[model samples]
Target: MDTPCAERSESYIPNAIVGYGYTEMAMQEMDEQGFGSDTPSGARRVSGVSSSRRVDRQTGRAGFGAQFRLRFSRSVMPRTQKGRIAGAVALFASLGLLAGAGYEGQHFLLHDERFVVPGSSAIQIEGNSHLTRAQLLSVFGEDVDRNIFTVSLAQRRTELERLPWVEHATVMRLLPDRLRVSIVERTPVAFVRQGSKIGLVDRTGVLLDMDDDSETASKGAPVQYSFPVVTGVSEDDPASVRSARMKIYLKFASDLDSSKENISSKLSEVDLSNPEDVKALIPDHGTEILVHFGDSDYLDRYRKFEAQLPQWHTQYPKLASADMRYDRQVVLEMQAGASVPTNNTQTAEASDPTPAPIKHAAPRPAAKKTAAPERGRPHTKLAAMGQPHFPDESAPTGKHVISSKPARQ
Candidate 1:
């Protein structure tokens, strides 16, 4: 290097890259290192700058670090903006493809024949007791042979629940040509007599008309329920009113049978006309007498009646009804000159066929149509006798009254 300044300065100037991420002093310092005594006056006067190396050993090139820094820094910002744009395009393209696939799949499900409900056999029913398949199938008659997805499950469920036997029903699509219907049948709590028509009633007071086909079919046997006949629930009464009366009736039975001795089984009929004073007809020894249990303490009242029955039977030879609602005494009604309703007399005859018919208010006109029961099985008739009058708490003398604890005893 006879003339390092002239030779190197010429080469360094050609390769020096001016760009961002650099200071003026660094460039001046780099220039001083590249040049020495022979450096030109114009180049030596430069200051407050920084720059990269003047040469690359491998290629004998100048300003390699500076060129790389300038190119890399300059491209970083522009490439970042370009990368965001490209990523946005790719995301939008993926979403469009997904939406298209979804639309196509939905179309296939709606119109595909493979998914159509074939026929009545494609429908599956479960959890039915007395409900026949024909009766439940009637609800989905229109849905048969239609696309399973097109069938409104909610609408079918509502229609199924409207049937007398269904307390709750669930309808669902069973995929690829079928619908499934599940029914929760209403439980029969008591035998309800609407006029002369005998049916079963649930706790909610909804009357259930059992399937005639199932009963008559050779494969299905007749369903027999051991329950007392409940009165005061009429077809004309609103469901709320019927339910309210049924509540009182349920409480009466629950309380009487709390001991599990089947105390409630002794009752042949229960009158729920007055919630405040519920009445039950019980057969003790031979004669059946109606006992007024009232609203609360039914079990206690029933027990008290049982305890005092021996003394009462001895004292009164002909006992018709007893009011056990009083705190200390039970009011007794004698059979002679008694004003018992026709229901009591009729039920009495049903329980004991030997009893002669007692005279009552003239029998009401017979209904226009009555279904003749099967020859072997007899239907219980709980004829309504309007509302019966029980002794009031205020007027003890209205009927014959005696202390619950007898002085003689």
Candidate 2:
């Protein structure tokens, strides 16, 4: 009778030793025939079933590895929008906490008194000559006690510079409890005269206040300054015109300052009332003489006048005014009733190339004599006077002299 398949399969493995020997023999036969060789129907079915089981097990293992990789990737990466949003929120929260800590630290530093300027002893000032220490302190005002971190350096500088003598100011914190201030004071170049009021002004035309008693004391004494007074510039004038005039005045003053004779020291005032013809007042023998100096060649003209001043003064003892604007000649205006000395004719002719020769005509007859001139009446006459010869080749060779009319004093 045909046995059932299960029963036949079970009888094939009835004993362990027999089953193991049968398995080894099957493996040897398979190796000898090659793994892919065709076999009997029963062996073929068993081999096909073993191969399918192995392939299924390998496929299951591959699927399990793939699933493991997918789970690991999902765990490590922010795959969902919610996960990405949560990460962004955590990053911003950390930044906010850092910002709050910084804000608190800064607030504490600003209020700290260790950085505050306590008093004048803790503050160092430099470059101030005309401005007093009190004046600079006043500029700090209520902000003196404020912490250095809270102090407005720009504002303090502006306030310090507002003082008339301060041209520029710099303010800075010098570490814990100290402040440093440096000032550039305006240097007075000349005095400004406007309608009887005199004020000090710098080369740039900035007016400096002279009304402060502290400023005078800072200079060590209430002294009278011997600066040349600049006239004719008014506050009503346009700024451009005033600036131009100031530049011209400074140029003239500088030239005088450079002279070997120190002519600037003798200068009493500068007359700019007539812009075309600038005049300078110089004290000569206790008399203030008005000197006409045209716009150019200030140094050359001044030197020439200085060289001939003594000779001219000797010749004309009462010299009232002088015109030195001429290239080669300087016209002299003498006091009325002054007679030209006879011996000076040769001296004057030798010194000046121009001027009519001194000629004495024969006395007119007595009949021509008119009524004696009134004693108290003033007599004015025009006289042409020659100038001293200058060795400069740039001077004009042609002879020229300006006639002068003495005015009643």
Candidate 3:
């Protein structure tokens, strides 16, 4: 008997499974089971069962156990071959369009005239006092005419900082053909004498190029620095050591300026050749008087010398030097052949008469006395002028007096 169409449709394999290479195999298995396209209901049922058994046995032996079961479901499989091919082509097309857009964008940025650096006037530079605008243009080089987007900002900034006076530099693109550059300049604190050449130096002892010509020399000569000169530091010295010496020089200069008497105004030169001993020369009465103040207690020693200057000037007309390296005392070195008073005794003798002598309890030994010279003239001596006076307990009446004695010549 012929099978009903509805019954035959239930036994036929769906098109979803045909894409998985099951259409020809299912047809061959059905023909072997004595069933054709016009098969009876009973034969169709037999063919369907036989084909399912053969497929499961082959796939299980081939190690596609789960895949074989998944292939039977229509919803789990790809609907058609044409849909997958179309999707792949669309994916490649979209990627190509994106790459082309990116390339065009890059090209526009590189060649756009609006983004090109217009001229030197378009570049806004600030915070530069030692370096001129023309000098900065030379540093930019070929980047001057290039588009702003193409300019290497980091490279330009590094070149700017390499300048002698620039401590730091920052570069920015202001868009539409403009660039902004700012600099932090190093400030000169003193003039450093390196061999015969003198150059400006900052507080950190970094030598700087004097391009501004702020300090002038003889007619048509190069610029010279007028800042206080610092010596004893050489180019061969280590950077750290030079920096340390600069700090010491600055400290001494500051101390001199902050003194009660403005010694810095009178200071023409400072000798730092000896690190442990700092000497200052003061111009007094058409001659320079050397003042030796040791490394430590500079301000205190300076004040002491200033206080005793008038007294020493009066006593010795040509006071060449006063050494205050000692504590509570200053050694006054007078000019050669300058005559000073022998002692206070001559002054006292001229003003008052001699008093009574002291008496001892027992008979005292005779005090020895040296014979005077043939000329019978008092010999010159060196004396400590500013020694702190303490009351003499041995005296009949205790009193603090200005101590003066003949200095040994």
List lDDT for all candidates, in order.
0.66, 0.60, 0.58
lDDT of 2 by residue, 239-295 (tens): 677777888887787787775666776676676656677788776665556678888
Off by over 4 Å in 2: 1-77, 115-122, 194-198, 211-226, 234-239, 257-261, 335-409
Q: Residue by residue across 133-187, what tens digits does model 3's lDDT show?
A: 7777777768777789988899999999888788999999997889899999898
Looking at model 1, report the run of 10 residues with the lowest lDDT sum: 387-396
**Best candidate according to TM-score:** 1
Clash pairs for candidate 3: 381-407, 381-408, 382-407, 382-408
lDDT (Cα, tens digit) per residue for candidate 1, span 1-409: 3455555553433323332334575554555556332434333322222354454434434453543221122443336777889888898999999999999999999999999888999999999768788888988899877888889888999999988888899998877888888999888888776665567789999987645666235366677777777888887999999999989888888888889987877776788888888887776565467788888999998888887777666656456678888885466665433444435333323434443333233333332233444443334323222322222112112233222333233
Query: Per lDDT, what order, best first?
Result: 1, 2, 3
Instruction: State every prediction's TM-score relative to the real structure.
Output: 0.64, 0.59, 0.55
* Candidate 2 vs candidate 3, lDDT winner: 2
The parts of candidate 3 lying over 4 Å away from their true place are: 1-96, 194-198, 212-227, 257-263, 331-409
Better of 1 and 3 by TM-score: 1
Greater lDDT among 1 and 2 belongs to 1
